[model samples]
Target: MSFDIGNPSYGLVFWTLIAFLLLLVLLRKFAWKPIIQALNERETSIENALASAEKAKEEMARLSNENEQLLKQARVERDTILKEAKELKDQIVTDAKVQAQTEGAKLIEQAKKEIDDQKKRAMAEVKNQVSSLAIDIARTVLQKEFEDNKKQEALVADLLKDVKLN
Candidate 1:
């Protein structure tokens, strides 16, 4: 721990310099170039990986937008289909109502025609019955009143002339 103001020994300084030079030479020859090259390659690989990641991110974003557009289109198509279906249902309902109305009208017309035919037939039947009854009554009266031929002929001619005048 004594202080000295003198130059150190040549051998010690020379050995120390030789050791430092050897260490520098060994590091330069064996470690520096490969370490720098490996560092550069690692940097390049990292840069390439980052670029690829950025490209993938862009592609994913584009795909996501496309998916959203497709979803919107699907929704629109479904809405259109639903609207068309409703319209078709409405048309079917309207057609059914029209058909029902036409059928009802046809049925009513047929019933009316049948009733008219029945009415005409009933009137004809009544007329036939009345004519037959009247003829029978007339025949019975004629039989009761007409025993003499000459008297019957004279009375029959007078009745016929009276009926013609009325």
Candidate 2:
């Protein structure tokens, strides 16, 4: 028998249909199942990565807020310490000034008392010198008066008359 290029055979058509169905079954069992499983795994990994990123972002925000609070607390503490130090310094200066003033007053009082004592002593010395000088002058004057016996007798008679009048 001669074969014609344009003529179709029923046997070839039947075998082609059977071979196509067999290929479908084999692909479904091996290649298609593995491909679908790989796609699902990739999807799950992408979702997990997104969730982890969100958690990391929230943690970063929390840490930032905590740092800000710590900074504010430190500033407050520093201000309080500085204020206390300033108060202490002012108190010390005030105390020193008061003590200096008290000491100055005491020294002034002591100096005044010493000056008064010296003045009293000087006045007493002056009085004593004046009295001694007066006594010496009076004795010299009396010796000159007694040198004249007639005058001395007259003075004695006057003294005796004054004594009788009292």
Give the backbone clash total of model 1.
0
Would you give me the overall lDDT of model 2? Answer: 0.93
Q: Using Cα atoms with residue i matched to residue i, what is each candidate's TM-score against the true structure?
A: 0.82, 0.66
- The TM-score of candidate 2 is 0.66
lDDT of 1 by residue, 111-142 (tens): 99999999999999999999999999999988
Q: Which digits, one per residue and each the tens of the lDDT, describe model 2 over residues 46-121?
A: 9999999999999999999999999999999999999999999999999999999999999999999999999999
| Candidate 2 lowest-lDDT run of ten | 1-10
Prediction 1 global C-alpha lDDT: 0.94
In model 2, what is the error at residue 53, expressed in angstroms?
1.8
**Model 2: which residue pairs collide?**
none
User: Residue 139 in model 1: shift from native, Å?
Assistant: 2.0
